[model samples]
Target: MGPPALYALLMLAVPLATIFAYTFWTQDGLTIDRTLTFSNYREAFNDPLYRQLMLRSVWIAGAVTLATVMTAFPIAYFVSFHVPQRRKALWIFLITIPFWTSYLIRVFLWKVILGYNGVLNTTLLGLGIIDEPLSFILYNANAVVITLAHAFAPFAILPIFVALEKIDRSLLEASRDLGETHLTTFLRVTLPLAMPGIVAAALIVFIPTIGDYVTPRLVGGPDGLMIANMIQTQYLRLNDAPMGATLAVLAMAIVAVISALVFLASRLTARIWA
Candidate 1:
């Protein structure tokens, strides 16, 4: 009754509690020791490999977030400002069409597009622009970033569009009335007003992309493997549930810190704009 008790209990509290307890347990061979200990957490921090992967995941997620927002903003602006009101629904519908397909399908499409003999390379090869198929685009952090940015594009666009749409037309007119150019009005008024949505989109895209296991697995070669992949290996393959839980909790903590920083930055931006 109080804020969907069953939902929170079954989904959040229960699973989190299990993971927390698991973090305090240790594994040896095929057996798990239920005795509570800090060894998992200890190993997580002391292990240099975990630290590097965590940092790399954060970096790739940041790249995806930046790329998604920058690309989404202009599309959102156009939908809010340039499109006829009657056709706005149509544009939004088209944006949502991709959602009807499977997420894996979209990712696989990117894989094919970026494959050695995939669409981009073949086209370039035919066009005589490149000497050989580009080798660096498909199986690295860049591919993971590109795949994630595309996967989360709609998430970024919707919030930003909502923010831009909510802006008062009168404010723009007033700016023009005071002799401000379009660019000046945009920088001075539009962008600042839309910071909340931009922030929302950034957090939304960044958090999940960092923990994204599949994108990195299919597209990311050994070098592009993220922390999530390691977590999965511990849980599924390595039979080390405690270590996996430790990595998971540590990842959540890092994401929490990053999210907090973003929230503080947004608050400061709001204060300055005010």
Candidate 2:
């Protein structure tokens, strides 16, 4: 415990403390003033652009979490219940194949797929689906959602699969013997049991997605940018480290509150179902 705790404090705590400390200071040109002040936080809360970016980040992250979890649940159920025991490992291996490739490459491939003259549009045009390629799919919030949902699908699936596997098949058999329909059994038994994994998967997707700068940079154009993009701008482009730190702290606080609410809500729901 001593070594691990010391390591955690050094790696995680020190960096976080430094960021938080930076938020209280001021930066002018090349000089970072050590005088403690709340000006950065004041500006962050009062600025309209910051407000917009924060809301947008939360909305996009929530959307991605919903889409990923909803899609992953069915696949996890299939793999856990329908697949043979011996082939379960194979199915999981296949599901993780996406992780084998570079994340940047995957983002680029999505660009090619969603671009006006890219593969999707080319195929649609050849099929005469429409006269022109659609412009709404690329470089927008829609593209961000689609790309992220695909990228984080495996993260959502594996946890839910693990949860589902832990469920007792005998309980399901008993439910069926009591004359409940499959849907009812699933709703009353399977779903509640799987809620833990669903919550975990949602958190895993939501937290990182909110902080992701790369996907938005590539696929998310002007309208699709998130708070992370703004943070990057403040830190690197404008050389405003204090403001960047302030934004980072605010984002973390927001995530913490939202995650707590989500976890509590899930627990309540699970208890009711139980």
**1-274 in candidate 1: lDDT tens per residue?**
9769988999999999999889999997888899879988888999999999999999999999999999999999999999999999999999888899999999999999999999999999999999999989999988999899999999999999999999999999999999999999998899998998999999999999889999999999987899999999999999899999999999999999999999999999888877
Q: What's model 1's lDDT at 232?
A: 100
Name every residue pair that clashes in candidate 1. Answer: none
What lDDT score belongs to each candidate, Candidate 1 first? 0.94, 0.97
Best by TM-score: 2
State the weakest 10-residue window (summed lDDT) of model 2. Answer: 265-274
Can you tell me which runs of candidate 1 are displaced by over 4 Å? none
Ten residues in a row with the worst lDDT in model 1? 28-37
Q: Across residues 157-242, which tens digit of lDDT does each residue of candidate 2 receive?
A: 99999999999999999999999999999999999988999999999999999999999999999989999999999999999999
- Give the Å shift of residue 156 in candidate 1: 0.4
Per-model root-mean-square deviation over C-alphas: 1.2, 0.8
